[model samples]
Target: MSVKETAQEVLKKIGGSKNVESVTHCVTRLRFVLRDFSLPNKEEVASIDGVISVIEQGGQYQVVIGNKVSEVYDEVLKELDGSDPTDKIESKAHHKSLFDKFTAMISGIFMPVMGAMAGSGMIKGVLAILTITNLLSEESGTYIILYGLSNAFFYFMPVILGASAAKYFKMDIFVGAVLGAALIYPTFIPFASEGELSFLGISVNMMDYTSTVFPVIVAVWFASKVNMIAEKFMPKDLKFLLVPAIVLLISVPVTLIVIGPIITLLSNVLADAVNAIYNFSPALAGAVIGGPWILMVMFGLHWAFIPIFIANMASQGYDPMMGLLLANQFAMAGATIAVGIKTKNDKLKALSLSTGVTTLFGISEPALYGVLLPNKKPLIAAIIGGSFGGVIAGIANTVQYSFGGSGLLGIPLIINTSGIDNGFYGGIASQIVGFIVGFALTYTWGFKEKSTVDSDDYSGNNTLLNTKINVNDILSGEVVALSEVPDKVFSEGLMGQGLAVIPNDGKVYAPFDGVVTMIFPTKHAIGLTSSDGIELLIHVGVDTVELNGVGFKSFVASDQKISKGDLLLEIDLAVLKQSNFQIITPILITNPDKFSKVSHENNNLILAN
Candidate 1:
């Protein structure tokens, strides 16, 4: 089906475009704020073509469509006559819970700038390595410049955060930037001294805002509120002139006098809490912290520790909590590598290997999402491995001297400048233990191989060998780009690129002589390998995996020979449409690289050629 047709159907199933207050999309879901939740039929919406699932969370009805959500959202906007919810209406109408609102706001504000922050941190890590090795002089101009480059992002964090927060808060970007700038202004910071500072007889408290998180965020939220009020009351002609002026005038002083001091006190309270936990029992604290680092990081709950971590670093020149996280990332890397080595599936192996390398460097999301989470046992093994490593770290009382993002580089970062120490050497030993324990445990007991032959194996991608091979048209129907497939695994060409078809006939014909190596229980997906070793995976309908065997009838079974034009499967199109399932079947050349070049005829064929 055409994208337009699919979009129209989706809109209709969700109570039409008129019922939608606004629509947005993330990586894999279409988020909708409806005028009335009672108006839309959720089960029917979930059954819609191209939809993976339906979720109602955080005051939004979400339609999961995998990687192609952006495309569908664009189509949705067009169908809605380009009407979108205004900023004020969106902020007011979402009705999200406090926790949800706070997390969403923080994630939205930090996501864009986080890449540069992490990258620059890695650069600093490398410089630390060079200096430690005596390969680069710490006093060199090159070192100074590169170090400055690394520090600049964090030093002016408020500016970057303000711009992003302003967009989320529906305030002027320039005003937000100015708000960030005023916090870090050199002259104003010195005047923060108690009894030494006054602004027109109002006492000013000495509060440091540099490299802080809550103050600027709270200030921006206040500024947004002030801006909205200013807009409502100010003259229309003077809105542009007076709105920002009024907002800044109210927000800055309020932040300085009230918000900043309160947040600083809160930061101290949070720090004291963490310190108390560590002092209770470092080993138990380390184990508890290390086991769930990934979960904390995923939900952004780890931000709560930022003030503590930064404060510890400033006061004592190191943070012990940093010691706990290093083990966790390395353990994740180890688990992923074990999966890569133990699995027979090629795609999973490749994914695990790549993600494992990043995990080793303290970038664990790839490993977390791609390998560990999907495979339950590996997650358990990695966490246990991390706990062991954390216990080792706690016993040694490990501390990191420098803050750099890489877990692999943490070894060097922890090294004391004057000389070597037990903490640095013990951290290395702990990471090694983490890697070994994670890999060994997962490889031994965690991974479960799929019980299937060539066709159903989830791992392999390319199976081409050295020789000339026959290339024949796979399916005879209306051809569509593989990228048009709503599922990211196929649409991104990650599963091997091939066109799809809207079957002209209800029956699926075999494209080449092959053995039906695998036939799924649902009969929605079939896998075959030709005598020449060309694997083909024919999946009928978008997200039909959810439908089980309904409306699908298989004529062939596993280990059966399939000749060209032989009837393989039959589908009841009428039943499919009534069930709200798509009829766009993807005929993928699962191992396209096996042939020098592969192309489909995409021709109208009454019978197989």
Candidate 2:
């Protein structure tokens, strides 16, 4: 199918052009904030041709379309809006939940730094192994260089975290980073040494700031809130300077005296609790963590565990959690690989295969986003496999001696001659076994049967059995017949024979067996010529022509034969709103003079087939 066809199908399945509120794109996904999530037939949308997956998280409905998402997003916008992009905001406050907010915060703050953190962690783990094996000396210059590079991320974590937190809070990220840096300055170090110290006559005695987590986050959050208030009250001319001054003055002291101590205490308590649990029953701890590892990945909160692993490695030179996590990685990888092999769609197969490889290399974002999350069965299989593997690793008392990288290859770092002897081979064997079991199970019994044939059945031509079309078969909304439409071109019968459909959603689809004749390069309008010579022009969303082709994507282009009910477009209505375009879509026929009469049968739920 061509891009145009895909775009139309997406729009229709999601409940037509009017249902859309706004649209946007990030990397490989189209992020949409719908005015009404209820309208889109999610199951049908997922089953549409050219779509990879649909994910609903953090109050956003994301469509994963792989590397071509940008191109598709552009086409979708053109279909909704003609030349200008929309700029409208949908109120997400109503949909906000504690879990949703927390996940959003974590994802926004941690995603960007993940690569750097992983790279540094891996390097540090390698250094630990070298030192443990007596292959490097503590004072060696080469070791120091590598160690410094690896240590940089941790030593300056507050800065990175602060920037990410600022972004989450929609505040000035640079200022937040500077404030975080201030917490670790030499001036604060003295407060750690002396019995008592004061900052500007305020008593400053609490937890040490170095290697701290909660202080910067709390401070930045406060700063963001203060900045917002200041921006509103202060005069436009002085707002920038005033906001920063007020935010810093209010936030720094609050952080030093209250936020830092409270969060530090909480962290310590949590750490102590985890340590106690581990001490009591390592196997139980492993089992508990392993069982829910997939959940952590889904919510994107796994980053929180990084500091714990680092602390354990620094204090005791080994951690059991890391070993168990390795099992989790392989389970996901194996499941993804199995799915890749089973898939017949070339695009899905390639994505699954690539993601599987990346999972093996300890980067599972592609797999998590593109494959596992959409296919529920594979994810469940992986979780079960991971848990079983964790049980084995725990029973054997396998522990990792370093804090970097994860998955099968990281096994070497876990083997310490001086530590508990589980033999390197034992850890390796458990991980391999878990991976194989997960792959085999998912391939054989975990998944639903995928479609082997093309979606052409839904895209072929069919003669309308009768001329009396039911408007209710289309969908719910204010109904207006073709003659009632205000546009002269539409009322004068210049377009076509079909009724003028004012969709509640910004979606459109093939009305009958036809061949797409012209898909406006901007993606705003599509022309379909039925096999019976009835021509149709589906101009999606009123005034969406102004979106300048931003969030629209098409599946089929000009001259492609289509059947009734075929998907033609997928639009990001959120983007349309963001670009200040209307969501109401107008379906018109460019060759209206040829038809005897155009009429509406009912006002809701239009059925083309």
Which candidate has the highest lDDT of all?
1
Best by TM-score: 1
Tens-place lDDT digits, model 2, residues 42-120: 4456556667667677655667665566677878888778523354434334367876765555555655676687677
lDDT (0 to 1) per candidate: 0.71, 0.67
**Which portions of model 1 show Cα errors greater than 4 Å?**
1-96, 193-195, 314-317, 401-404, 409-420, 453-609
lDDT of 1 by residue, 1-609 (tens): 566777788889877766776566655567776766655655567556667566665556777665456688889889988544342222224456786666555555655566676666667667766787888897999999998997777677777777767876878988998998888888877776534556667876857677667778888988999999999999999999889888889888888788878887887787778888887887787788876776676555765565477667655666788877668878889999999998877888987998799777665665775678767789888888888888788777777765656567667667665556777777887788788889999999878554221212222223432322222244446777665665544554445545667766678777777899999999988998877786778888876765788888999999999897788888877877776666777666665544444443333111111
**10 residues in a row with least lDDT, candidate 2:** 451-460
**What's the distance in Å from true for residue 5, model 2?**
12
Lowest summed lDDT across 10 adjacent residues in model 1 is found at 600-609
